[model samples]
Target: MAPDDERLLKLLTTAIVNHPRATMKDLAVLAGVSKATLNRHYGTRANLEYQLEAHAKGVLAQITRTAELHSAEPLHALQYLIKEHLTHRDMLALLLFENRPKTPPLENEESYAKDLDAFFLRGQHLGVFRIDISAAAFTELFINLVYGMVDAERRGRAASSRSASTLVQIFLHGSVASAASNLPE
Candidate 1:
């Protein structure tokens, strides 16, 4: 990212994370730039949102790719991705709500969805993930569960890593495998 772009993104992200109702003017002030400068850089709120969405997708892709390169199994890789997301809850929450008004198609978005599908396929082939469910469905399930946990944490309802981990374990066993009873104790 260019220096100016980086600065703008930092300001916008911080504002979104810190103040849920942040506006462009708030971002401009936080970024220490004039509104004209912000408009010149981003063109409009829609344009800025598009850029933020793309940036978030790129970040998620990089996280999934890194996990794929290092982890021995698909589930382990997913766990790593979840852990990383949990560690950056503020940023993740901001990204989740950004550009949502004009949501992009899944294929057009650069998120980890495709990589996750591939990962699920691999797990299914390895007998780790059930073949009954479609990859897209599985991906959605994982996302919903993870997002729920994040929401719970944000609301101070869930406060521990153990709670998050347990949620993941339950999710993996219940949805991915054919029988939860078959899972390791």
Candidate 2:
């Protein structure tokens, strides 16, 4: 993407994170652009939302790349991802809570889902993760825990309750192999 587009995406994401149901005009104002510019760029609310979802998928892909989730040992990758998600609490809020899953990814974005599925399957095969849950559910639970911690911290609802280590502990204890499940921390 061009630098201009990237800038717009960042501004728009921040706007949405701050006000999820903002009108196009509201978004433009929050994004520091005019309504005309927003219209010229996005054409419609649907288009804007589609772009945001794509951006979220792009962020997730970036996280996976940084974690080397496919190439690294699954346990390490999982731990890195849990910590990374905490480090990216705003992104998690945008992805998990603020953005409703109304738009499907474009054709090019489908591989992210496939890659995560394959990685979790690898973990299960290696006995790093539990076999009882489907890969999709396992992934969902992990994300939900991260979201909970992020949300709690964002709201200033808890101090010690919202640490990434706590999330990692709770998530790993439930998701990992029975013996290793005792090993969250």
Candidate 3:
């Protein structure tokens, strides 16, 4: 996408975050574009919503790719992944929104799911994560834990300041290898 379009998408995402129930026209204004322009570019409100999902997917894919999950030490890479996801302002805000369209959750995303499955499998082999469950289950569990932490922080059930580390602890505590589980908390 062009830089201008990307900026528009970002602005729109921010608008969505700030005003979850805003109409398309209101979103366009908050995003610093006219309704006609938003319509001209995206053709419809649903298409704009779809673009948001695509943008989010790209953000996640890029974060995972840069984390190099497949090649790094499993525990370290997993920590980095969780930290990056939690610190991503746009994604966090989007996740907090109650009214975004029906985009599938990140765990169901095949491209990154495969990478996570491989990473989990490696972790299990290295005696970092548990082996009782399938690697796919680990992958899904990790994603859910991350998302749950996000929700928890948004709802005041958790503190955002420590959420990343807390997420790592929560996920690893339940998923870690039996021997690794004996380490100091």
Candidate 4:
């Protein structure tokens, strides 16, 4: 897509994130274009949604490229992924809102899952994470924590450094204050 096309799509996505129930006309206004222009570019609301999905895919691609998820300790890598995802808060919001159980996984999703599983397995091997909990379950917990953080931020609850540390601490250590300390050093 042309640079202008990309910018307009981003604007449309931001608009949608801000007002999911907005009409095409409302979106056009938010995108700084006329209804005719939006229609000409996107053809229909469904088409606009399709573009948004494509944009979100591109965002994920960039994150995967730059995150270097394998370059750090498994726990640190997971934290890096969370921070990276949070940087694309608007796109994440759109993607989550559009998520449906029956929706097929994206092409890259399988690889992403494998990478996460490996990360968790590494943590388990290092005794940083509990081996009793399946890696898949741990991954699910990680994703849920990310979603919870995003939701909290969106609801006017600003995430602090302490909030992030607490999240990681909880995931790594559980609720018991001494759980992490008791782990083998």
Best by lDDT: 3
lDDT of 3 by residue, 1-185 (tens): 89998888888877876677788899988998899999998887778877776787777777889888878988889889998888765665575454656866654357877888888898889998889899999888878888778777767898989988788777876657778867786
Off by over 4 Å in 3: 89-108, 174-185
Against the true structure, candidate 3 reaches a TM-score of 0.81
Query: Each candidate: what lDDT?
Result: 0.70, 0.77, 0.80, 0.75
Clash tally for model 1 = 0
Off by over 4 Å in 4: 1-6, 99-104, 157-163, 178-185
Report the candidate with higher TM-score, 1 versus 4: 4
Q: Which ten-residue region of model 4 has the weakest summed lDDT? A: 98-107
lDDT of 1 at 32: 81
lDDT of 1 by residue, 8-87 (tens): 67567666666656677877787688888889888777777667666666666667777772335876776787787676
Candidate 1: the clashing residue pairs are: none
RMSD of each: 4.6, 4.7, 4.4, 3.8
